[model samples]
Target: MGEQNPLCVNVSTTNSTTEILSRYDMINWVNDCLHTHYTKIEELCSGAAYCQFMNMMFPGCVNLRKVKVKANLEHEYIQNFKVLQASFKKVGVDKNIPVDQMIKGRFQDNFEFVQWFKKFFDANYVGQKYDPMEARESTIIWGGTPPGPSRIGHNNKVSASRLVHATKPTTRKASGLDSKHIGAATQTAGGAEGGGSQKLEDLTSQVSKLKTKVDGLEKERDFYYGKLRDIEVLCQEREQRNGKSVGTEKILEILYATKEGFAVPEDHVEEGAAV
Candidate 1:
């Protein structure tokens, strides 16, 4: 709704012939334009950056309110893409966003689309300054523990340590009391330790279960990655036999790509900040 008419409406017609932008160039362009710290193109798969790009080019067209900037799960990533696709339709951009391939976090699919987008952005962006963090601040859902592996495990370990500390028996200077009372106190202390031991065992079991679940997920991920790699190798051989103009060349690029664009000097690399 921000801009009813498309600005660079002619950009799409020439997109097929648009020169392939290098990975290093695209990465820097995206990071600079979006004020994001993405070193890898695959990180763009979350779709938040793309949504923001549209909003930057055509303000208010993309509902920043709908994008989950901190999305990690596949479904959450899909939601971000949905917002992006809707915005594209609204703004009259006819680009075919390969959401299916892009969401897989594959470099090639994302690279191809991002390359086209950079071309689109270049033609349309009028060099206006936009702060992506400020634009997206309202849209970030605030309550979850940060995205990554096992904050759960860290939390469980901390809780287990606290439980053990709280349940530990402390020795007291004996006030003169009957031996019976002393024995009773000892029995009560022993019972408390027993209860603590049981609770500790329960927590241990929970932690073990969590660990097992994580391992299984890792194996599943490896399995799919291996399959994708196999397919890439197969396609590569066929492409070589058939020559470089194979129909699936773009698809193969998506599979074959493994590097994170170009190398940044060790001193020049900027670390990503937390959202």
Candidate 2:
């Protein structure tokens, strides 16, 4: 849903015409958003233009209680909030991110939009930073290698310790605050981690349900196998009673093995003739 509707999701094109959004860029932002905002997305951050677009599509996030977000959306199209919202509002799409993806969507136990905002402004809205929540609970940071035409340095590191690092701009210069408000973000990250654990438990429950289904299928397979074997045995028994190759041949072989050496043929030995 980037740029406009009917998006070519997963489409491959390095041509200039294609508007590319990479998943790697979204990891920090998605984590930060969740850490910063425990409230429903209806009360999410301030991006007026995006707000304008989203309000148009999902007029009421109140009624739409559940949503399912894809990994790609969270890690790729996240910067395009309106587009993400519109996709969710589209009649067929769900608005919540599933819990299975929630843990994976984040960078740390605690992170949020406020943290992401700091990073974003610091990074100067670099193409290396963009994200969106695709579902009620799920978030996928696209870990796959950069696609062709994709930016090369989003995942590079400043040092061995930092897999990737983005130095945020100073609050004194931008917001006139005494220090970076990132600590406030850090405080909220704790709650995000806790929420993440709960979501993981939900996924565990789903796995248990799937295991139950697999066990039931195995039982059914055993039952059907027993029925087939019984049918084969019945067929053999009937063949023995009647006459047929294999079954009948087996009976003849047994009889021949048991017979005394050269008994006169029953037909050739005439009993007392009924003259």
Candidate 3:
């Protein structure tokens, strides 16, 4: 990407309608005011004697450390203001207010900016209150065994045990019948699996044949491309050789015409000798 040109501003001491100042000029003026005091308009416009009147303001609730943090935040705000100034310059606006005046007007009747930063700090501060009782309850619920009927419930436990024992051999006989059925299913499945494998092999062979044909076609295409390139080179060389020959023929024809025009007549030479 090409580099963008820096924006230039025309500075005027007198409040003249002819000369228009830009947002960049206002930012520069504000930076100048931060350094020194100015009496003359040209001195105000120039780098020498502009005033430093603004100081950092801190909330009563915050400590010295918080004040330092707020100072950093103010620096970031100034940087953002500079970026806004650049955006205004890029779009070439016709008019602009001074940076200090704009800030003053925005905060004149409102404390919203200050209140917003206060709320931001309050929300982000991470001093969570600890609760020992709640933590213990949670640990017990997570780590302890689940509550239910114990082994001392004698009648119910004994009855369940007898019922499980009585059904055991009947369960074994049913499982034996299921095993026989599964053996027949296995034989049927083996036949289907063999048929699927054969179909897969046929597909694989067809794919290999198609791949070989495509490779052959690609090789043929490359061969034709090489031939076309060679033909183009030969045509260019022939045109160049023909052009040189034509130029030489034209030069020789001009020389022959000049020689014929300059030749002396035989009768004129005889008349001069007689005289």
Candidate 4:
């Protein structure tokens, strides 16, 4: 999880004289090593060293739970177990007394550590609770006031909203002359006016060129459209001629039947059959 949500592992030892690490110290260690926050401790495991350590850090935390200890050396294991019991007693962890009694003389497998901790956490977990007022005050202290809007002129202090709604300032003459000083401003005004007129002429020329191009395009379009119309008229005329030829062939067939005894011309018969 993120730095704000992290898994916490509490290790304790049997040595009472060893310096005890605090919750904040443990958190700093976790952040330095794992780059995660130690917001809430979820699991507690006991051993000679771990029990001593946790007892010192969280002296009377009821949430601390015991896990089965594994050791290869039987004598050392017994010693560690005794140390854990002593540490628990020193920390006033009376709630775990029943668990200690039940798991006494029995060693939990190292492989089942994860499963054991999962069950232990699920059964005994409690979220950290904080006061609303304290939380708000802490936030205010840590996160100061929000930044103000950016300034424009040295004298003007406009807000962001006002700046968005403000209109752009119109361009003005550098000299700021008025009608009363018309004669004095004449030369400069004439120069500016002459430049503006030149620019206008250039724009008009460009417009004229564009209009000529559009007219040329329109004329070309009309030329193609006229050609298409002529082709359509030719097709219609050809279809009409074909219809008249068919009618003529039908009349020739009737004439041939009337002259049944007389032999019809071979060319005329072929032409009528083809039509």
lDDT of each: 0.61, 0.32, 0.31, 0.33
Q: Please give, for residues 1-275, the per-residue lDDT of candidate 1 as tens digits.
A: 48577544536535567876666678778877666655455667788888999999999899888888867666788899999988888888878888877776766777778877877887788878787778887432211111232111343343322222232211111122233444554555566575776655665565556556654554454345434534544565576578676466776555434445643333211211222
Tens-place lDDT per residue, model 3, 1-275, is: 87655332322233342234332343344334232221111112111111011011111211222111111122433443454344435533223435443232222111222232223223332434423223222221010100122112343344322322222122234345445555544555566575776655565565556556654554454344333323333343454567545654454333223333453334423321231
In angstroms, how far off is 79's CA in candidate 4? 99
Mark the 10 consecutive residues where model 2 has the least summed lDDT. 160-169
lDDT of 2 at 223: 41
Residue-pair clashes, model 1 = 1
User: Which 10 consecutive residues of model 1 have the lowest summed lDDT?
Assistant: 167-176
Decide which is better by TM-score, 1 or 2: 1
Who wins the lDDT comparison? 1
Indicate the TM-score of model 4: 0.19
Q: Could you give the candidate ranking by lDDT, starting with the highest? A: 1, 4, 2, 3
Candidate RMSDs in Å, in order, are 18.6, 31.0, 43.0, 40.7
Q: State the lDDT of candidate 2 residue by residue for 1-275, as single tens digits.
A: 46445311222223353333232234334346433221112112222223222322334431212222222233232443444445445533323422222323232211233233233233323233222343222333212211111111233112211211111111123232212343433444456575776655565565556556654554454344333323333444465568466764554343223234633334322221221
Off by over 4 Å in 2: 1-192, 245-275
All candidates: TM-score: 0.48, 0.19, 0.19, 0.19
Q: Which pairs of residues clash in candidate 3, taking residues 3 or more apart in a chain or in different chains? A: 36-50, 36-51, 37-49, 37-50, 37-51
